[model samples]
Target: MRELTRDDVNAAVKGGSVFASGGGGWVDHGLEIGHAALSIGRPKLLSVDELPDDAIILTCTAIGAPAGRDWQMLGKDYIKAVQLIIENYDGKIAGVMTPQNGMSSTINGWLPAAALGLAVIDATGDIRAHPTGKMGSLGLASSIDYETIQAVAGGKPEIGSYMELVVKGTPARTSNILRTASDMAGGFIAAARHPLPIKHIKKHAAIGGISIAIELGRVIMEAEPDGPEAVLEAVVHKTNGRILGRGTVTTKNVHYSGAFDVGTIEVSIPNRRLTLHVMNEYMAVGDDEGTRLTTFPDVITTFDLKKGLPVSVGDVEEGMEIAVFAIDKSKVPLSSSVKDPTVYPEVEEMLGIDLQSYAFDKEKTIYA
Candidate 1:
């Protein structure tokens, strides 16, 4: 296990921003939470094999968009959310893991772990940012026997939108409740839920997920001195990612609603155009030929042409020169939900577009 440093946090944010796919949590919130974790204690990164198979692990994440108002996710709330889950579980709680990687989601376990003196397991529900809790629940989505225990704390009561919620039920039921609470809380909220054994994590979760983000972040940072193109190359080389298109942003239309920021982005190349479908994050990328270049489960990131830094969908705007990058799903670690057909319908219905054509192979398993 290794302790996280400020430099590590900076690198993770840069890398996390890319994996965030266009949305995760806010970059500013990620910085604040990361710094706070480092300051209070040593947040240790642990591999799945390091922990006992019988130990219990809970997922800590920020549920909501950064665009809304009246929702205050205080630093203390992260810890409180975890504490609530610990109280609910009558067994030993060994560590915490992130549901997915994002600007803030990547660091979701840091503050709670540091405050509670728990290990930050180097595994994730999903390698990239996803919209719903079920999408990051490993394969627990179909497990009717896996009882879910959830705890949520966020929102400011002054505006009639503050709540500290806890629920016990099926994974789907509990997940929906939290999403609704987040929407009612203005836009987002602090959430902790899903208790699983180390054995289960080792079998289904993406191992070394945090380390991958850190390495990718470090590579991007190291290339910064050279130039944006070098930084772009480093990003692609490290993840074996592909550059879909490079051009100025011609149109960006995204709106925050129902605790999710959804929309589309259009990039104009010299002779071709690239379009990105967004649902909190860039879910799919397609060209003028109607061929889907990349889809969900794979990482779809946009880099600022001048800054050479990864940018999110919530932050992208028209007239900005940017480059769209994609790493095939086959090359990246993915959760079982990525292959689950049930999760795609909501996103497709929201954007009114079909994405099943680009879905990842369902036959693959982490244990394999």
Candidate 2:
């Protein structure tokens, strides 16, 4: 176990933003949570092996869009969400883990852990930000009998109203309900759900994910003095990822459908064109040659050419030059949901892409 320092927090914001792909919460909000947690209490990072197998664990995360202008979340909302979950849970919670790594999601469990005096498990449901809750529900995608209880809190405080919601049901049903709540509560909200034993987390969660992000961020920060190219090289070396392509954004079409922001980004090179699909986060990428280069479960991120920082889809506009990176799934510690074929059908159906056909060999296709 290690105590997180200010450097860890800054690096997380940088690296977490990259891992967010396109859809994690805001970076400023993440900083607030990280700084506050480190201020009042020392946030310790514990690996799953350090805890007893019988220990109870819960996934703490924020739901909704970073671009949701109406969405308002406060520090109290994050703590309140977990407190509500503990109130209903019959078991004694041992620790809290993040659903995914993002600018804010990386720090999602910290505030609650500090306030409630619980350990922050160094693991995540998914290494990258995703739209649906089931995408990060560990291995519960195939567990039809599994029922989860979730608590949500956050809303437009400017309107003088903040709402709290609690629901118990199958992961899919509850996830959809939470998405709807996000729409009604403004746009974004704090959430806690998908409780499991430490044993289950050990079997399905991405072990040592937080540490990986922190270390990767630290490496990138250390390389920054050498230049953006050096930073990019460090990331590729760290994750075995490669730069798929680099070009200016020729076109971008993004639409917010109350709950999710679904869209596509098109980039043009001299002889190649790259197209990306987004549903909160980048899901798939294809080229003008009619080849599906990458898909979910693998890391797909874009960096602005000028600033060299990871750029979210919502933050991108037409004519912005960006570099695209694609990492092999094998290089990263993946949660079970990412490997399960069932969790992907909906995204495939929505985007109309055959992810299964490319799930294994597509990395070779990109490298070729």
Write the residue-wise lDDT of candidate 1 on 68-99 in tens digits. Answer: 76578988889989999888788878899998
Q: Give residue 327's error in model 2 in angstroms.
A: 0.6
Query: Per-residue lDDT tens digits of candidate 2, residues 128-161?
Result: 8887788899989667699899999999767954
Q: How far out, in Å, is residue 63 in model 1?
A: 0.9
Clashing pairs in 2: none
Q: What are the TM-scores, per candidate, against the unseen true structure?
A: 0.95, 0.96
Maximum-lDDT candidate: 1
Error of 2 at 129 (Å): 1.7
lDDT of each: 0.85, 0.85
What value of lDDT does candidate 1 attain over all alpha carbons?
Answer: 0.85
RMSD in angstroms, all models? Answer: 3.2, 1.6
